[model samples]
Target: MNVVTRSAGIFLLAMAAIALPGCRPASQPSGQIITLRLSGWQSNPNEKQRLDYLLRKFEKTHPTIQVKYETINSEYMDVIKTRLIGDVAPDVFYLDGFEAPLLMQYQVLEPLDRYITPEFNLADFEPSLLNAFRYRNQLYGLPKDFSTLALIYNKQALAAAGITHPPKTWAAFTVAARKLTVDRNGDGKIDQYGFGIAPELARQTFMIKAFGGQLVDQNGFATFAAPNSLRGLELIVNQYRRDRTAAQPTDVGATWGSEMLGQGKAAMVIEGPWSIPYFKETFPALEFGTAEVPAINGKPGTMAYTVAYVMNRKTRHKEAAWKLIAYLTGKEGMKAWADQGLALPARRSVLGELGYDKNTLYAPFVAGARYATIWQAGKHLPTIRMNFNNQFISALLGEQPLSDAMQRAQDTANREISWAN
Candidate 1:
């Protein structure tokens, strides 16, 4: 029997035995409780509190199971890898899409297909998010939540600049950005830039894809130095260097793109739904709005980041661990979790149930989910990302041409990947 069926049968038999006058079921381990260790990095205190509440609720429904949740704040993936090597990893844990390929490749994660019941409604999840955890045609994880990029612009700045609406295409966006940039007080220094950008690969990968650029070939070698990739990359470089309408967070003394927009150092940024509550709390009076990330070459594109609940292959209690994963990623639990709006629900039904598609600020992010490039490449992505970020920033700062920077990044990344293999 499948784990789900067996578990249900055991529960039903135990209930039947309890109904009899003095009969105790031999199959039931008298008052035996299984404790599951769960690990994830905490984004904030509220997220931790909310998860604790959800765990309590799950324990109530599955009375025999208790979950001990741990937060590994720093060096999360490094800690997880070490624990996996030591066989001391949590029974169930969070796995980011970017990191999933390596874990799945190493065969350290349990294939969840057998444990999944039809009633689990696996199809309810967004296919792209689910595909992130699949390897060799087998599934390994269930996405807990996700976020997609969108254009977040200052509403007041647009109006003041006589732009009635947010730009719908890259060309229009460039024009709008030029108009929005300002240098007040005749200081010769720009007081506000039109756009704030993160030059890291995570944010720029979509740009690579925007113009027929591929991050990796079928053989998983870095190919981002190809001419097509540079075409898209040069747009960013030109905007920051030639146009002078874009600035990085450090240039304006801010820490990230969202902070730059919030601080009025930039009039626009491409960000995700997490920035909504952040703006409301940090910049309460900032008039902001969101739109689908401006189309590139008449094609819409964005990036999606998702994290999943995956079972450790070595867990003693596979069934129990799956029960926790199921309940947490299930419709009810997901709805409750997503109600906090920390991230978008991975389940399509839960997203609709929460009415995120109707919310003005979140609708663009929701729309982008359909076409967003999942922020996952092959197993060598971490190495590729590191080299790309280091070199891409140099190009953005005008140290060298975009072509040279990308070629150097690609060559270095491929050498490391080849050595590792």
Candidate 2:
């Protein structure tokens, strides 16, 4: 018997043996407790507190089941993979879309399709995100939350620039960015940049795909060096290296785009829902607004990221583990998690109930999900991402032309993929 069933049998036998004087068959009122282990990476203090509150509520509602939560903040993927190989992984754990393909291919994750019921409403999930964790028609994980990139701009800076509204297209966005670039002290040095950016491939792939550019061919070989693919990326390179209007976080001595904007070093940024909490807590006095990512060639595009709660196939408590996963990803629990606006709800009903679609601050992000490119490829994506980022940064810094930089990146990435295969 499995761990959950074995534990249940032991409880029943103990109850029969210890039928004491005048004691009912069910020993204690609530009966024996079974514990399930869950592991995930640590985010912020607020996120942790809310999760704990929700978990405590779950425990209260289901008195017969208890949960054991563990956090591994540093090198999360490495730690999780190690535990999986060691056969000591938790019953349930956090999994990102980027890493799901590799684990699913190995068949180490439990197939969740059997556990889902009609009332669970699998159709409630966003289709693209839901499809990301499916392998060979078998559902393996349920997306707990998702975020799509949107235009985040400082309102005071826009007013200072004499702009009335956010840009609606690529041409307009570029023009506004230039106007937003300012030298407040007139000291021949920039006091604030127009845009703050990150040069990583994770953020740039959507740009590559925006104008019909392909990241990989049918065989999963790197193909982003093609002229058509480079077309969209050239705009970013021009803004950063030629116009000198945009600054990376490192250039402004801040850790990320959100920080640069909060510190008044950058007037605008493209970011996700997680930035909402940071902005409110870090710079309560700063005025900002969210808008849909600017359209490119009259077509809108952005990137979407999702995280799911997956079950370990080696788990001894399959039945109990499924219950925990079901509750967390269900309507009630997801609403409790997304109500604070830290992450958008993955379930459609919960989103509609929370009224985020009507909220001006979050509508942009929710709307972007329809057109955003998910940041996932084949199993070789992790390898391809590293090579692309290295050369992509070189191009942004004017070390070489965009075409040449992409060529070097594509060639190197393909070679690595061949070696791994």
Candidate 3:
């Protein structure tokens, strides 16, 4: 059967499974617990505390069911994939929206529609974000938290450069970056850079979209060779080569852009809302503010990354698993998590409750959600990313022309997709 038909079949089977008596294991002498495993990557101390509190509440509400939480410390995605392939995956686990398409294509995730009740209210989530986890009309995941990119700048750096506010247009940004960049000690060695760009798939994907370029076409083919896309790549490379105002975090062995900015080595960077809390805890003395990512060619844009709680297709305890998923994503759980203000809430009402709608620091990020381009999750995402990285780095090093590099990257990515098919 085709994908949609197969998805429908799965949904029907799930419904049948839920409806039939004896679907769950024997009631364990009426009082024993029904244990389920929930897995996710590591979280901060505060987040862990909150999760523990929520889990305790869940256990109290459903005394018969017990959840065993597990964590993978290293190579989380690889570990999760290996477990899924080995048929030992957790009943419920964290799934990034970008990876949902791949998991759905492999038919490894359970369709959630069968379990969603009237109380679930799937419509409460942002439609575009919810659509990210839905494949062939079957929802595979429910978003728990989300983040969008914004320009984070040092107030002192801008003042020293005679700038009063963050730049709003590409032209103004370029000017400010040049002025803010300096060889501070005048020893011909640059002590401070105007900006640092994180040289990763996520940041580059945002750059491509900001310039009105689609990384993949409607048919799920790589399409980064368009002129607009090439211009976007050029903009990044030129900042390092021509403007001399930007450097990649890798050049300094920093894993994230936020770290580069936190150290006071860079005056500006584009990062997500998560960085705010991270910096607040890591370096309370640093002074900074966030602004919407400057428009490129007069268009507002940014990149949004989100993760959802999903069920495994092979989960034997479907009912118990649904209950756990529901509680984690429900109004109560969402409010508890979002109240910490570490990440943006995926639910609309929870965002308002958390004061994100009125907080000026968070308002731009929420506003950008409507225009932000989401990362793609085509079957060939891994291969496409590899090629894009290689070619992008080559352009950054002046080893190839922007157009030539992008064309070669596109060709390589398309070939990989063809091989996969």
Candidate 4:
């Protein structure tokens, strides 16, 4: 027999040794219950509670299987990679689009196409989200959730500045930002800046593409330093340094863009749906509005982030793992999870059922989904991201010219990628 057949036979034997026939599902051999391991990071305590509740419901339906869920709070990717190399990784785990390419390329994830059934309605998922987890025509993951950036503005702040609506174009946005900036007490230091900025590759990537620039060339080497890309990036640097109307989180003693906006440190921020619930819970009285990100170079653009449930290739209980993946990513399950409004559902039906597209608070995010750039480049993205962020901040601080900073970053990232290859 072939290696695959032999492995299947051994897996059956192992199951037979542990499974109890009486409780086994109708299709599988009678055996004792199987326990599957799952790992992921929790964004908040409520998210963990919601997942635990869902897992309980899943268990009630599939009595023959049990899932042990674990949370990796820090350095999640590093920990997962170590566990994978040691052959002790969870049967299934969360995979971000940014990290999917590397694991998919390494052959560490199981191709999920074989397990997908017509009844599962794989076509219900958003094509862009699904494409993030595909590698070489094989589906390695099923996107569980996604989010796209939108311009989140404080209503009172906008009105105070005499702006009746959010800016629709880059030129207008800059003007609005300058108008909103104020030194309320004549203390020489601005009390409320017009915009809060995030100086990271993930947020700036869409800007790079706004002017027909690419993040990586055909060979997956860094190309973000090209002239066209710099033009878009220069807009951000100028807003912060020359216009002096934008501030990074550090400038306002905030940890992130959401916090910067929430505390009234800034009037606007580019964030995703996750900020909706955050504002309601943490800043309940803060009146806010959402709008599609301003057009750059006469083109609408924003960033989309997604995560998927991927099974480990070496999982011994392939059948059980597949069942769990299908259940979690299924329409019913997705709706339950997305009802929290923390993230957008990946399935078109679930998103529609949730009414996010029609809800004024969430419509901008939903609209941007149609054209947002998926936040992924290649397997070397982590390396490229680190180099870009380090130098990009230097440029934003005026320590170096934007062009020189980007050039240094590009050269350093490509050098590191070459060494790895």
Candidate 5:
């Protein structure tokens, strides 16, 4: 069998092992039922439904353990921090890649290296994704789901514009976008835009990387003011002003790329796997396809957002908590989650079994995995995001030049980094 097929076979074997009766370790059960609290931000109705099912299955398999689910609706990080300080934190919680560094620095999370078993096959996860949760070579969390950016386009819109396929280069992309934009009613107002670009830290960060700009220096100092970085920033702003074919999410009060594309207000967007299920459910009538993100000056690029399951350092039930985490992130649970097509799996083996390799809508996302840039994790991410968001929004409003805005953002981010140090 080929490498992918072989990996899939191994993953199936692992799942079988997890599903077998009496798969728990030989250590004696405490004989007392334990209740574990798990918490995370709710994404959508589908995610909640899947999680409820998984939790119920876990409860059935381990009769001695009861799981309680809680969600913080406002300011997730702040609420989680407050609860941790109050000594009432959940036993397990979702940790975003950008926030992991801050939490790890505060010594709030328990390192999970001790709980890793040979059967867990940590090597199965992408090394880059796994590195996000590591502190001094000690693993702290296991990735649950990951997302990578891809070009999502409306097939009908492309056909109407006389374009045979999505653009492959930035030059062609601009041309196609201009062609697709229309003032359909002769009201001198553009009714359809070719693209929807969100003006936010995450999107800008990805752009900077696409143009070969690093957000931080070797010592983790902010470096977004570099010339190439400014060039990258100008590329998107120019597309908005010069071409008039792109609209920001704020232009339509749409919070995300999927919504704008779903409404047919935008013909194309750069989004992640999460939008797949959202589109399938929210706008079932719309026909769309995805391609790898267009090359920037001949170099392919995209962004990745990942989250992991982490344990509380002060939890009284470390052993039981680890068991639950292992099972949830193991081959069985990971396969089940990925199979639902809600999000891409972090493991290579699971992706094959789910047929993501041959799936045209999902193949670009998978192909971009190796080249996609992961969001930076550090003690200053929160501050950096705040500074970038403010300046980027100003640039988007045409109040400042892209160069000036990026320089100011870099300076402000550096000051925050200095203060933290």
Candidate 6:
């Protein structure tokens, strides 16, 4: 162990000296009153307030335990890694699915298998989501919440284009997009784009998998340059370059897809559940509806983004940390947090109780969980993702052919991962 880790371990043993005092009352609890630190990126102000309220309830339920919550926003992973190396990291913290593999490989995370009990009901979580935190047959984290991509469209725009319903398949979606791309007032400038695209690998991974494309081989080298992968990606590039119907956020000077929609620059977008809360709060007057992602090559596909809570292996208050994690991801706490609709619950029971299955606005996202492609892979995924995003955007902008771009992306990613290993 390094000096920092050794010091932390020594401090943990030193803390045991003051575990119990002789002056303790008979009615008092046997264990020491401990404070467990939890770290995560905070959402918007309102959502952060809701989480604070929920944590307060947990503290009340377990009188002997106190939660010291901390929020890290900018460069989250960089700060977290520094803290971990210094042995000053929080006892529990949020880990994105895409980043989990690197941390797991370093063995910095506590394997949660032994901490989980039957009553905790590990099976209640969606298997696809839960599997993201598992490595080498050991569970390293519990997913707190998740969001899956779906088609969000403007109702009035579709009606103006003489379309009564959203597209159900890729072919029909293509037609709808063409019709929705509008040029009002004959200004020779487009008024609204057919679709707003992010053009990042985080959103395009499912498209790569839609046409029998494997993102990576068992050896974790990038396989996205394969013919099958280009076949699926060709549609996106063609739409953006040839059809002139689709546009990215920068084309309209918007920050993201949600901003493009809220500003009426795009008629449709493929986004996640967070869009609902955003639309309601920022553009309540805008009429919108959501539907399941259109099928690709007769196969249902979408992307799922998730974050999980994991324990630090160096934590001194292991039992207390587990108690906080268990409560935060547990049924009651999940229901309280997910009721706000900022994101969907990872737990089946919480989702059912929230009635998202019956609500039309939320139903499509709930249904997508069954076929959503989780945005996670091996430890080399970060390298692969960076190269793909850079090269794929070149294709989207008509600066390069899709096939050539992906070839360069795959080759570069493999070279970088090889150097990293």
Best-fitting candidate, scored by lDDT: 4
- Note the residue pairs that clash in candidate 1: none
Pull out the clashing pairs in model 6.
Answer: none
- Put down candidate 2 lDDT per residue, 286-396, tens digits, no spaces: 999999999987789999999999998877677778889999999999999889887889998999999989989899999998988988887678778888899999988
Tens-place lDDT per residue, model 5, 253-279, is: 788778999988899999887888889
Once superposed on the true structure, which residue ranges of model 2 sit more than 4 Å away at CA? 1-32
Cα-lDDT of candidate 4 = 0.90
What candidate 6 gets wrong by more than 4 Å, as runs, is 1-31
Higher-lDDT candidate among 1 and 4? 4
Write down the lDDT that model 6 would get: 0.87
**Of candidates 5 and 4, the better by lDDT:** 4
Q: What is the C-alpha lDDT of each candidate?
A: 0.89, 0.86, 0.80, 0.90, 0.81, 0.87
Tell me the lDDT of candidate 5: 0.81
lDDT of 1 at 259: 98
Tens-digit lDDT track of model 3 for 1-421: 3443344345434434443222233335577678889998766678777887888899999898898888776878767876765568899999887777777766777889988888788888988888889889999899998888999998889998899999998789888889988897889777678888876667777677766788899777888889877777677788888888888787656777888888877889998888888888988998889899988878887888888999887777787888998999999988987787678889998888888978977887888788777775575676688788888888787898878888998997786566455
Cα RMSDs of all predictions?
Answer: 9.6, 9.4, 5.4, 7.3, 10.2, 6.3
In the range 1-421, model 6's lDDT, one tens digit per residue, is 4343344344334334322321211232476587888888977777778889988999999989888888898989767876876668888999999989877766778889988999999999999999999989999999999999999999999999999999999899989999999889899788898888889989998999989998999999999999998887888888889998899999999989988888988999999998998999999999999999999999999999899999988777777778889998999999998898878999999999899989899999999999999998797787798889999999888788888999999998887666555
- Candidate 1 ranges beyond 4 A from true positions: 1-30
Clashes of each: 0, 0, 0, 6, 0, 0
TM-score, each model? 0.93, 0.91, 0.90, 0.93, 0.90, 0.92
Candidate 5 C-alpha error for residue 178, in Å: 0.9
Give the residue spans of candidate 3 off by over 4 A.
1-32
Better of 2 and 3 by TM-score: 2
RMSD versus native structure for model 6:
6.3
